[model samples]
Structure formats: structure tokens, C-alpha cells
Target: MKKKQLSIIENLIWNSAGSFTYLICQWLLTWIIVVHSKDLGNAGNLALAISITNIFFNLACFNIRPYLVSDLKQCYRSEQYSAFRLFTCLASLILCLIYTCMFGYTMDQIICVMLYMVFKLGEAWVDLLHGFEQRKMRMDIGGISLFIRGILSVLSFMAGVRFSGSVNTGIIFMTVCTWSFIFLYDMPQARKFEKIAPVFTKETIKKMLIEFLPLTIGGVLSSLGPSLPRQFLEAEQGSKVLGIYSTVATPAVFVQVAATYVFNPVLTEFASLYQRGEKRRFLKLLFKISFFLLAVSGASLVGGAVLGQWGLTFLYGKRIGAHADLFLPVIIFTCLNAMSWFLWSILIIFRELKALLVINVIGVIMCILIMFPLISKYGMQGVNDTLILYTCVLLVLMAVLVGRDIKCKFDR
Candidate 1:
């Protein structure tokens, strides 16, 4: 029992450390890029290329990631991981190639996209690692992977950029190095629980593919919210606009990184527990934590945005700082949107696919609309307002659905 208590403390500390490292590294990298590349167009293009490549990565990996976490754990535990992994790799590689094809770009963009794939293939494995680790009842392996990325990112930033080529090269190279480490070490550690099954059958792949269908669509639509819109804004608005948005939006990443730290492991654990018939305890515990964290993070979003406004004004001159007001609402709405996301996580756990569909569908519709109209009229600030409205609606919807779910679950 004492051991259990200590383990929990260690997990929380490592998790917090991991998130803090991510924020520091991100802030430092952004500052360097901003200082060196005042050409908003080039910086925006870089940001856009990164966005494009990541979106492609997310598209290819999609639901399969979480699918592996829940599904592959069965393979690992049953000692069937050899066949399971073979089929998983074939499927992932095929999808990666397919996603690569979908990226239409100049040679430079293509090169960046390919490099991103190599790095992503490694980094994205974190999803699978988290699943396997938590199934063994230890979340630290995944936490360490995150800490490693944070450390490398900081190291790369501290090394500083003597040239544009160097910074650009460092970005992908450092990521590749870190992710390779994760892919190498973490997979074997996770495989300790892996059960090598005899048959890697056609039916298994078909089943995995079928299960991924809804999630795939939902994911593509979801990725568009952050990734695609930014690119669109960069194209229509400009890189300076992208940089400013990124700067203002930086604090939200802190909230997200921290939220993800706790949320990802819990989501995996909850999915596993639900499968094992601990549904009642699972929902009760989830509801409490979900509500508390959502609220805390939601408040933090507001505080962060307010500070972001001041931070921007000071960092950039008044001319640039005037744009800070445009960003504050985006931060607020993004936080609220994040709260609804916690609720969605519960919905996903219960395989409430239909509800999940409705939620993402509605949120996407609002976001899409916000993209066209406000972007035309008010530029960044308009996008910020519409996002706030979008998240507000999302939270309202979440409250209604959660209230309904709670009442129905206990109606008897």
C-alpha cells in the first residue's frame, strides 16, 4: 500500500515535469524562430508546412493509435504481439504511404513532409506505448518519453541558430532523434506484456479497419480545427498573422499539454477498466475528475489569455501588440472547447459513437463557419470571437448530454 502511494506521487511529479518541459521548450523555440526569421511569410510557411505534415500524420494514424492501445494490449497480454505487430506495421506503413501521396506540395514541402513522417512514425508510437504501459499498470514509460522530447527540444533551442538552415534542420533532426529513442526502448519494454499469437489473420485486419471507420472520419474533421485553419489563415492572412496567433495561442498549449498528461493515461486506463466490467466505478471516478479538471483548466484558459494579451503587448511593440486583443478570445474559447473535449473523452470510452458523431459534427460546423466569415471581416480577432462562441456552445451541449447520461444511468 505504501508502495502504491509512492508510485502515484512519482507518476504525478514526472507528469508535471514532462508538461513543464514541453512549455519551456516550445516558448524558447518560438522565440528563436521569431528573432531569426522576421519574414512572416517564411515563418508562416514553416509553420504551415509543419501543420500540413502533422495533419497528414494524424490522418494516417487516426483512430488506429487508440485502437492499438486498447486492441494491441490484448495481443501483448496474450503473447500474440509478434503477429499483431506485423499486421499493425503493414497497415501503418501502407497508410503512411497513402497519406504521403495526399500531400501536394513543392519539393521543399515534400521533403519536410517526409522528414515529418519519419519523426511522426516514431513519436506517434507514444499512443501505442501508453496503452501497453498502462495495461501493465505503469504510466511512467510514456511520461519519460514526453520528458525526453522536452529535454531534446530545449537542448536544440539552447544550441541556437547560426543560420536558417540550421534551425530548420534542428527542428526535424532533434525530433527524429528523440522519437527514435522512444521507438527503440519503449516498444521492447511494452512488449514484456506482449503475447505472441500464432495467426495474424485477414479477419483481424478487416475488423481493425472497420472499427477505425467512424474514428477516422471524426479525426480528419477534428484535425482540421487546429491544423487546417491555421494554414488557411496563413495563406489568406499572412505569416506574421500566423506567428502572432501562435504567440498568443502559446499559453493554450500549456493547458493542453498539461491536460493531455493526465487525460491520456486516464483515458487508456478507463477504456481497459470498462472492458473488464468495472463500469460503475469507472464512470463515477471519471465524472469527478473530468468535471474538476475541466473547470480548473477552463479558468486557467481565461487567466492565460489575459496574461497572453499583456505578454504580447510587451514582447512586440504596440503596433504588433494591438493584435493581442484579437488573440485573447481565441484562448478563452479554446479552453472552453477543451472542457467539452474531456466530456467527449468519456463519451468515447463508452463507445457512445453516435453522441460522439453529433458533438464533433456540430463543433466542426461552427468552427468551419467561423473560419470563413470572421476571417474575412475581422481577421484574427474575428476568428477568436467565433471560436469563443463555438466553445461556449460546445460546453452547453456537453452539459446537457452529461446530465442526460447521468440521469439515465441511475434511473432505475
Candidate 2:
């Protein structure tokens, strides 16, 4: 029996529902910690753990999902990608542990960071499965898996924190529940479409590492670009303030998450269009997505301006709401960052890995040079200012790259 394939609209709907549910659950977890817990430092600790683990997560996944989906030529088998992913995930875990140990974090913070990394490690594994599902154009399956796992993880975390009153316990519950979903649900669903066993090959692994080295480095630097500012904020201002910033900035992140929901389902289409030399259709699709993202970003800015303080106060309490002045800059930062990533998808589709690396390297350098001074001077506002500046620089460079690539395609 042949399975009926979903239309693009169907795929988009599923992907958006799943991704939005998962992201909102994450946001809500932070909100739960803030509203229920007596100590604000718990939120701060979790925020710090997330900021640190995000970079490591990029390292573990090595930006491979996009590459996996865009491999229209099927240069490598799913097993090969799986093998490499396992290797990277293991290596990234070890590095994460070493980093947490070496950093001056206290024992509790170290435990918190390591626990969060465990959860992320599970996510990275499931992500590989999702990549396989996406390549089969069965994103609906992956979306369902994400929805289930997201719900289980959030509920478990909520229960754990409510009972134990510790963020670490909450993360432990989230990790266990999430991994259970992966083994019992995600892997089984993935196996229905393709083989889940990883086939190890020395030559293929080496080839992928070399080919993807630029992207791996670029991914780390891209994560670092935002993380450096948070690190500076925490250093200068303290965890409570960092927690407040994280809470305040949470709503702004919806803009970026929304952008991903729009573009991710169409990534395969982008590759197919470009590969088939349907340049006109490709450009039309690209412009349409970009315009939609801009429209959403504009709407978000307006909404933030109108009800930003009240919403923050309602969700996170008056302490966090007091910093509502940072709302606009945070929204602008997220919007610019989201647009930068939209351009990033184009570069990934074009396989402009070297250019991506160069752009990220310059962005990270700019971030380092300005982050400390800005955070030290303006405090939380300085952190937002630095991010805004960093993402602006990134957006401009990426636009130039995408433009040059498009012009060359048209000229030819």
C-alpha cells in the first residue's frame, strides 16, 4: 500500500503546531520557575545552563539537519549521517562536561549545566531521527513526535519542580521523560519510514567531518555570538538580573521561532527548486518568506510597544516588568537575528559553507570586542544593545553573500 504524501500546506501546518508547542513549552518552563519558585536565582541558573548548552548543542548536532535535508543528490546514506551524528554528540558531551568543570561555576551550577546537557543530548539524538523523517518528506511524523515529547517533558518538569522545588530536579525529570519518548515513540515512528540503525564507515565519517568543518565552526560561532553577551551580563550584573533579562527576552524569541516554523517546512522545496534550475520560482518563494517574516516582526514590535510591560508583569512579576524598557531592543534583536537565520538557510541551501564560516567569525569577533563594554556600561540594556549591533552586522554580511550568489545565478 502506498502512503499518501502530505501537501506543503499540510506539512507547514503540522510543523508549525509541533514546533510552536515545543518552543512554548520551553518558554513556559522558565515562566513556571519564575512564578512558582521563591528564589529568582533558580531561573537565572536555568537560563545560564541553557545559554551554555545551546552552544554545545550546536556542536553536537553540527548543523547537520539542514545539510541532511538538502542532500538532494543523496551523496550519503541516512546511516552515514547517523554515524557521524553519534560521534559528534559523544564528543560534544565530553567537551561540555570538561567546559563546565573548568569554568568557575559552583558545584550546584555545574550539576545544573550537566543535567541540562543530558537533556540536550537526548534532543540531539531525536533531532537526527527528525532529519530522517524530514528527508522522506514525512515531516508530519516528526512533528507528532516533537509534540508528544514536548508535552511529556514539560509536564514532567513541572511536576518535578513543583514537588522538589529545584530546577535540577525538574531538568532531570524532563530528561528522563524526553528520552523515554525518543526510545518508545520517536524511534519506532522513524523506523516505520527508514532504518534507524547507524552504519559506521571510517571514510564517510572523515569525509563528512572535512566537508562540514566550516559549518560546525560557523554553528559554534553563531551560538557564541549571542551567548557572549549573556555571559557578560551575568558576570557584571548577577544571575538574578540575567534571569530577569531571560524572562523579558522570552517573548521576543517567539519572532525567531515563528520564522523557523515558516521556513523549515519548505527547505526541501528550496533545494529542489534550486537544483532543478527553477530560479524564478526559487526567488519568488524566497522573497515571499522574507516578506512574511518582516511583516510578523513588524507586528511583534507593535504588540510589544503596546502591552509589553503589562504582559511581562503578569507573567514574570513586577521585578521583571520593571525592565520593560528593554523590550523594544530585545524584540529588534530577535527580529534581526531571525532574519539573519533566514538568510543563513539560503546560504546553507547554496552550500556556501566557507562564506558562512567567514561571516560568523567576523560576527563573533565583533561581539567579543563590544559585548563587555556595552554590558558593563548599560547593564541589561547594554546586553540588548550589543546583541542588536552583533545581529545587524551579521544580517548585512549575510545579505551581501546571498545577493552575490543570486546575482551570479541570474547572470549565468
What TM-score, computed on C-alpha atoms, does each candidate reach? 0.80, 0.98
lDDT per residue for candidate 2 within 9-80, as digits (tens), equals 888898899988888888988999999977888899999999999999999999978888888798888778
Model 1 spans > 4 angstroms off = 1-10, 64-107, 157-167, 195-200, 268-284, 298-302, 313-320, 393-399, 407-412
Q: How much is 323 displaced in model 1, in angstroms? A: 2.5
Count of clashes in candidate 1 = 9
Lowest-sum lDDT 10-residue window in model 2: 1-10
What local distance difference test score does each model get?
0.60, 0.89
- For candidate 2, list the clashing residue pairs, or say none: none
- Listed per model in order, the count of residue pairs whose N, CA or C atoms clash below 3 Å is 9, 0
lDDT for model 2 comes to 0.89
Alpha-carbon runs more than 4 Å astray in model 2? none
Cα error of candidate 1 at position 18, Å: 1.8
